[model samples]
Target chain A: MKYILSFVLNGQPVDVLAEPTDTLLDVLREKLRVMSPKRGCDEGDCGACTVLLNGEPVRSCLTLALSVAGQEVMTVEGLSKNGKLHPLQRAFHEHYAAQCGFCTPGMILAAKALLDKNPHPTREEIVEAISGNLCRCGTYQEVLEAVQAVARGEYAEVKE
Target chain B: MGECIYFAPTEIGEAVRLLAEYREKVTVVAGGTDLLPKINYYQLKPEVLLHIGRLGLDYIKEADGKLVIGAATPTSKLASNPLVAERASALAEAARQSGSAAIRTTATIGGNLANASPAADLATPLLILDAELLLTSTRGNRKVAINDFFVGPGKTVLEPDELLIEVSLPHQKGKSVFLKLGRRKAMTLSVVNVAVRLEMEGAQCKDARIALGAMAPVPLRCTRAESLIKGQVLDKSLIDRCAAEAVAESSPIDDQRATSWYRKKAGTVLVARALARAADMEG
Candidate 1:
């Protein structure tokens, strides 16, 4: 019932032993201790478990750990390099996108995936990209602004 | 609960063999968007999880004038595919309105069909397109019309040993439209959905297909409404009558999301809007 899964996590290669019943969110948060991806709703309703699978945003809570073998999986913890935050992270801070901060990591990662594919997404595009993420704090207006700011390259060099 | 085994087969033959070997003990996972939820809700428990994501079953192809979509093809792919947009506009529209971007990126067309939810957004469009489902097992492969695929709510004619392979949509020259009435703009289940495909011959309706969802036990085509519209001039009176017929044909139920009475009224509105769009009539 155990399988060896080798995948590229963030920017590093990782090989982990996984059970078939283990979800990606569980492995990421419990086994790997990469807790950026939260387990808000284990049933994929909350976007608190969003992560990038092959540069596309997906609900890690719904993804099976075995299904991610040989695929590139990126978590919110992988968004920074050399202690520097990603542009979207900085934009969130600058634009006050986070209120409760529980949905922040997932929102930022989802926006990162969108910006990676579309560097200059319009306001409507930004709205569509983050539609999966739910910010119960009702910070949607600010989240939209933060993502738009990053898309406009306004927060490209902001410090963490 | 006992430990479950996972199998990722790269080839269709291997997948078929695994399904045959496991039978009722195995569940095929494509996107996991639906399956994982069911598992989390304790609605289903399988001893084996067979992943078909790596089986090269995620491509959209055109073969012999039919649009052949592999079962594992994600809703996001269908929503953004240019071929789907051009040939099967209604399907593309359904894909676009299915769920949020993240859900769409992982939700497969096969899962949507296999789930057999009456509110499934893609079902009505596929029905309008005259789609056929290709199912394979170790025994053999068989194709069934989309209309015949569903037996009831959350149920399909698919056997436990069979895995859905592909969905083939006939190529038709016409304009098609899909309209869904949900609770909210995004990530909301359909209260009522309608798909209309109209083949026009200089303003007169040459042929028409109308399919309604979330208003019956299974997504169904409004045959009487289609018959009334076919060969008739596209007009307000005709559209109203057809919408009424469509509403009359549905057997909606009262659920937490909506009431049967509300669904019938909304069904009429969706049908009218879809017919108007098919007729090139704008507000």
Candidate 2:
């Protein structure tokens, strides 16, 4: 049942052996040892397992590994460059957005997906964009503020 | 874990052939938003998972006076496509309201219909649009009306060898609106959803279609309500009567989402609001 999956992980091409039933989240976290994407409510209801598939946010839990065989995938670990934290990551830290830090990766990545398309999103747009991501710690306002800060050019520089 | 075989076909012809060969042993997964969840829950256990993602079926085009949406077209496309928004606003609204941004990005229209959930949000809007599904097999392709596609809850008339290819509907001349009442604002299934499309000529209603979801075993078009409102002038009393007819047509059941009685009453209110919205009237 194992198949060789050739996909672009972050910016590099990766060939990982995975089973047909294995999800992208499973392969990313277990095989590749990329632990940013967490499995929460593996049914796709909770956005804890969200990752960008070809620049669009999707439920990695519901996505079969075979489906992403020839696609590009980006996890929270890939958000930064040259070992520096991405703007969203810096904003999250500065604004105290990661209350429990469980949903932070998914939330920040979801915001990245939104900001990539609409860099100047309004408050309402930001809320709608992150509606899929659930924050059990009730840090929605903080997350919103962090994303808004980045959109406002406050967190434009990469952090050390 | 080792029991299932995943087949990702690069060609549509091969996909059809594979389906014909496997029959009941295979299950087609387009977006996997619904199917994978069901599979994870052990609710469905098909031996083979046929992935039709690369079949070149994802498209939204208009030709020959009809808007044709390829089966693999994701809900996000439906929500953003200007053609769909202008020609079929109800469908656009329904697609936007169906799931969260992540779910909408991946879930395809084909998967939404083929899954045949009674609470399917797209069903009501598609019903109001009088959508026709293009079901394909190795034998050939056939276009079936949306009304005849559903059998019951989580069931459809799709054969094991058939794959839904396209959804086609004419450009209707009217105002249409879709509304759903759910427990939460987002990421929740509808308790009772209603879609209404009405053609108005001055003060008289020329034609109308009333479609309700999660109110029956399958999403149902309220023919009685349609008949009642069609050719009738806009009025509060007539709208109330039409709403009552809509309630009478559906057969809701008690579930975690809502009670049968709540669905009946709330369905009536939503239907009346949709109808009034279609007529550009206040309810």
Candidate 3:
């Protein structure tokens, strides 16, 4: 039941041996050793396992590993360039958006997916984009401020 | 637990052929929003996982005086498509309120209908739009009215070998609105949802359709309530009566989302509001 699943991972091509039942989240965290995407609910209800599939946010836990063949997958590890933090990451750091740091990865990726498509999202749009992600530490206010700061072009130079 | 075979078909013909070959053993997954939860929880163990996302069924177009939507079309596309918004505003609204942005990106209309949840956000709107589903198989294709599609909660009339290929909506002259009273604004199932469509000729209602969700074993069309307003001028009193009738037609059950009693009260109010909005009435 194991198959060679080939895909573009964070701008690089990868081929992993995975079972048909293996979820993209499992392959990334276990098989491929990319640990940004976490498995919280295992079900799609909780957005802890969210990652960008083809530049759009999706539930990695719900996505079959084999189904992502020949598609682009992006995790938080793929965010930075030249060993520098992406603007969103810098904003989150400066704004103290991470307390427990569990939902931070998924939250940042979700916001990145939103900003990539729409650079100037409104406060409401920012909320809608990350509504699926649940931060148990109750860091939503800080998360909002961080994302809003990025939208305001405060970290425009840091973006790559 | 046996090994599961995964098949991602790039062509519609191949997809249907796989369905025909595997029959009931194949679990068709598009978004995996619904199916994956079962699989992950070990509630469903299928011998085959047939992925039809790349079968080129994602489209929205007008043909033969009807709006044809590919079954595999994502909910996010439906929510944003100009044609769907212009022609099926209620459906667009329903799609927009379906799930969070992440879930909506993957969830398909076909998967939504085929899953047959009583609280399916798309069902009530499609019912009011008088949509028809085209189910295809190796045998052939057959169209089923949206009303006749649902068998019960978590069940549909789709045969084991059949695939829902398309959903078509005929031209309708009406102002329609969909309302959902969920636990929260986003990422929640409907406590009670309603969609109402009113084709008005000046002051009189030319035709009317009312559909309710989560208040019955299936997403239900309120024919009796719709008949009350048809060919009559919609007034506050008549709309109230129609709302009551719609709730009366539903046999709600108590669940985690809501109680049957609460659903009756909320369903009535939601239907009345949807009716008033569709008819361009006030209060």
Docking class of 1: high
Q: Per-residue alpha-carbon lDDT of model 3 for B1-283, expressed as tens digits?
A: 5898989988878988999898989999988888888888889987998998888899999999999999999999999999999999999999999888889989999999999999999999999999999999988999999999999999999999999989999999999899999987688889999999999987799999999999999999999999988999878999999999999999999998889999999999999999889888965
Report the lDDT tens digits of candidate 1 across residue range B1-283: 4788889999999999998898989988999988897786677777999999999999999999999999999999999999999999999999999888889989999999998999999999999999999999989999999999999998999999899989999889788999999998888889999999999887799999999999999998999999998898888889999999988989999999999999999899889999989988756
- lDDT string for model 2 (B73-173, tens) is 99999999999999999999999898899999889999999999998999999998999999999999998999999999989999989999999988898
Deviation in angstroms for A116 in model 1?
1.0
Instruction: Quote the lDDT for B240 in model 1.
Output: 91
Candidate 3 chain A worst ten-residue window by lDDT: A151-160
Top candidate by lDDT: 3
| Model 1, residue B96: C-alpha shift (Å) | 0.8
For every candidate, give the share of true A-B contacts it also has.
Answer: 0.81, 0.76, 0.71
| Candidate achieving the largest DockQ | 1
Candidate 2 TM-score over all chains jointly: 0.98
Clashes of 2: 0
State each candidate's clash count: 0, 0, 0
